[model samples]
Target: MGVQGLASFLDKHQNIYREVRFGRSRLLVDGCNLNYLLYFSSGLDQNHGGEYAAYVTLVESFIAALRSCDITPYVVLDGGSDVTDKKLETAAKRREDRIRKAHEAAASGRTMCILPRMAELVFIQTLARLQVPVAQCFAEADQEIAALASEWRCPVLSNDSDFFVFDLPGGFLPISHFHWREVRQSGSRSSVSCRRYYTSSFCSFFGLRRQLLPAFAALAGNDYVKLRGIDWTRFVQAGTGTEACGRLEGLLCWLKGLQESRGPLEVLEEALGLLGDLSGDKRELLQNLRLGMEEYQLGRSALSRFFLHGAPPEFPALEQEAGLVPGWMLLPVTQARLSGNVLDVLRLLRMNLGFGIETQELPSANQTSRPLRQVMYGLLLGKDRSSPVVEFDRAGLGPISVPVEPTFTRTSQRLRLDSLPQVALSDRLNVLLEALGVTQESLRLLPPQLQLPAAVSCYWLQTAQPPPDLQRALLLGMSNTPRSTAAFQNKSGIQKVDVDVSHAFSQWQACLKDAAQLNQLLGLPLPEPDVSRLYQGTLVHQLVHRMRSGGKLKTVLRSDRPSEELYRSLLSVVRRIRTRRTRQTRQKAATRRQQNPPEPSADLQRLFLQDEETESEARAAVAMQEELRLQEELLQVRTRYRTKERSNRSKNPDLARKEECRGRDLL
Candidate 1:
């Protein structure tokens, strides 16, 4: 369904397409494509316990691999199909297949909806939790991928081969056979492995350029096109003798010439001359191709949003901005309680996003019994679609606020059903006690297994006192709500026959089986499966395990094992970190040498800084030499005075006695 025969062409000439891979390249990912691979890898689950958790785990692992290799990933998922698309019939066929599967699952007592949308939701939520940029395309993902790749100037990573036809300048990378590509230096330095591929190399080998790819793609039918009898192999066989490949290259050049002027009628004349003699039905064939080209053009127009950065109506420039209240708002029974209600249900709800809702206050009802419920309905009704809007990380909803953004807003400007944005989702859950009007502690008083199941049991019980077992079955996701009734009771007095409990025991058994399968799928044992982790784990099993009642159960006691893939990923990350550290150290040393020219050795360094012991040795030698010089001078002076003093002493003994007396006085 991708470019027809493109895979075979690439396989036939694989060796000529060679390029070096970079660790830090930007990659655009096809989220749905990767999720299907993971889903298949995880054998079919018999039960649906923690389905969201399983999806979150697989996606996180794949993302980790991309990140460990230093790739900046931009994830994109397919949104609801375009109503005006040329391929609605194909999309409908797929939906019918899902409907059939849903029926079959219902018949088999499987409560979980195994549709692809659930997986898509899980993907979007996981990326949101990680604060990663993700976009959901309004229609087919192929054109959007091409458009965004062009805008972002990064390689597209997808299993689909439609990218070759899309004619991206950067080309696409298929990760279906993803592995390390070893690149050796021109000299005998060394080789290193990285994940990379270049599709342009393949185009060049086939004697095609970026501009000519879409023409070549048209030759082989694509999703939006249905041209016939223009296969590459057919062109290869059209030439005479051993020069057929050269003739094929000539054909490409002719096609490129036709496209230079960009006029359909003018190109049609040249196409007729080139293709006229190829077949007896040339006119009909060319006409069919012309129609296909028109459709492709129309498809591109429909998907321009991907290339167009959203420019909403201009908002008023603000003089100042509001700051986030990072601390929790402790809503005691006073503020959280409704007009007449005494129990505080709002306190149990965590206003996540590390920010509060930011909107104006809804007019409060003075006399209403359920003022909070009235406020919620008013907020939902007051949402404006075309209002000037600004995206904020955290906005307090101290006033009237609709959900900050709609779920499908990434790709879609419209929806069949208004999607509620602020709700619980996979891996990052807003665990709210919705409609459970009771003390948080009182709700916790139930047995551990009974707590979550009790919420569902209470819903059906209050409506019609249906047995707790049916609610338990419904809550476990082991049985579907009968087609006769709504998913759960609503404003209308919706009623249902008692849920068939013939398979209640079997359903419980299936829950255990699904939990076991998740472990097998995860291929490790960390703790007995906790369903809530599917939502609240934040993708860390260790953290989720600690949240368990038993407090950090020994992993060894559960299962002492490691996965090879896990270790390999860890090892790759370790190598990357080591390489980074080495590069930094080398750069630092180079800078140091540039500044100082030479690094001093230990002894030289000591001399340069004047160590105390070395300084003391030099000081001691100088002191002793000075002392010797002074002693020598004193001895010489005494020798000169000695004879004169002796002569004087003989001349005057009495004077000597007086001098002796003066010396005694001086002493």
Candidate 2:
């Protein structure tokens, strides 16, 4: 029947067959074969253009039908670029032969040139216009198509039965007239009956038990060779008959022997023995298989070694027990496909064999199923070496615990400001202020060095709330005399206290200005209330003064010799004012004594005698009081010396001696 007739017939009888729906079904087609048929067929006479239109229409119709059935089809094409040089030459010869035949036919006027060319154009145009998803392989179209189909687990549409040659596990069905026949037969009988007929027929004709179609084809050669008038019976006989069967038997026997061997060397010895028994083409095939297996086994050994110690052998042997090369040893795509198969086989084997059981030397049913592992084991055993048993240290996967002692617990060590000497603290504060870039203006009012005790005290007053005692002490020290204040109030000023307040306020304002300058120098951000600025400036001055003087008056109660010098300098300034006041008082007293010197009378003289006696007694009492004061002073000195000696014995004697010297110097 023509294509249209066939299509119409299939459409009419579509419901006759029981429909089977595939979950996530996809159809993979051989584009090259389809295109070739279309291009060569005279049925697609596209020279008149009408044939090309018809071809396009036919493809569209087919696509529409597929869409209606919700079947997605992926078409694959071959570019003929991947063909080997030898194959290319052969293809060229075949093409030439076809062209010559066409030319001869045209010359005879038996068949028109328009017919073949039109047919070719129609097929090409039809395929090009196909709306379905398509992929094209550079070379080895069959291999690419088979691989993709296997990967996607899609049904295949092809005239060649080679798709089954790969032995893909599931979801691949060959489409043909045979399928239509099966469908029709199923409708006439029961659905089950039709399925059984096709299934049994396929098994019996193809020997489907192991899906050994490839092996059969390898033995029988091509059926078309006979059609082309080539006598391939001898080749077929040599491949499938006594010799081929014997070779397979010998191979299986060798596999069994390798399984029994102690190591890979022994397996290799058995393989060589099997190799020695084969001859001619069969011998060559067996040798190739052996080499592929040896390479694969070597790859496995290397991988094992790598997993164990992060480095593999330079050249390990390949195992060839499965006839195919090891999946792990192949190039990416081939390796991916083979690895998938290997994993599946391994899973199935594992399901039956269980985990953690050693079956290295034995080729059980589990090993037979897992072709990859079987090959590896065989290579190792044949080569006379036992595969290392890798046992994972599961305990290494847990958290590590460290024992710690209570007495050795971690603690942060920080310097205690209270423990620092006033001079040392002052030096540290000066360093800290300098590091912070405190300005000279802020430091001008201070002594040369800054101390931590004064700095810390000033810092607390600035950042923290000032203590009541400290605030009271500061106010008391800053108090002005009432006379000076009153005199200023009467002399071109407001109230005397107001005058003092105004002067103090101006000083405070100057201090704030100094603070601002210091903030700029120290890279501190300006405060909104400017309290921080004021505090920092004051702190710098105080800390520096304390540091320079060697002892702070406010924080450190005890005064050392260096501190006494600072106190003495302040006292010297105050003493000048005190001395001037004392001199004025003496002058006033002298004038009073002179003015009130005498108003003497006779009765006063008589009274003076008795008064003189009372005066004498008063003088004696005053003398006795002075002696008692001296004795008390000596007793205090002696008591202080004894207490100090005891304290020195209890503490660091050297530190005590130094402190005593410092106290004596200050005194």
Q: Candidate 2 lDDT, tens digit per residue, 616-651?
A: 657755755554454444344435545766786678
lDDT tens readout by residue for model 1, 277-380: 76657666666556555432312322234224421112111233111110111111011111101011111111111110011121111111122222222222
Candidate 2 global CA lDDT score: 0.32
What is the RMSD, in Å, between candidate 1 and the native fold over all Cα? Answer: 33.9
Tell me which residue pairs clash in candidate 1.
356-395, 356-396, 357-396, 357-397, 358-396, 360-399, 360-400, 361-400
Best by TM-score: 1
TM-score of each: 0.43, 0.29
Candidate 2 Cα RMSD after full superposition onto the native fold (Å): 43.7
Candidate 1 Cα lDDT to native: 0.39
Q: Score residue 533 of candidate 1 by CA lDDT.
A: 33
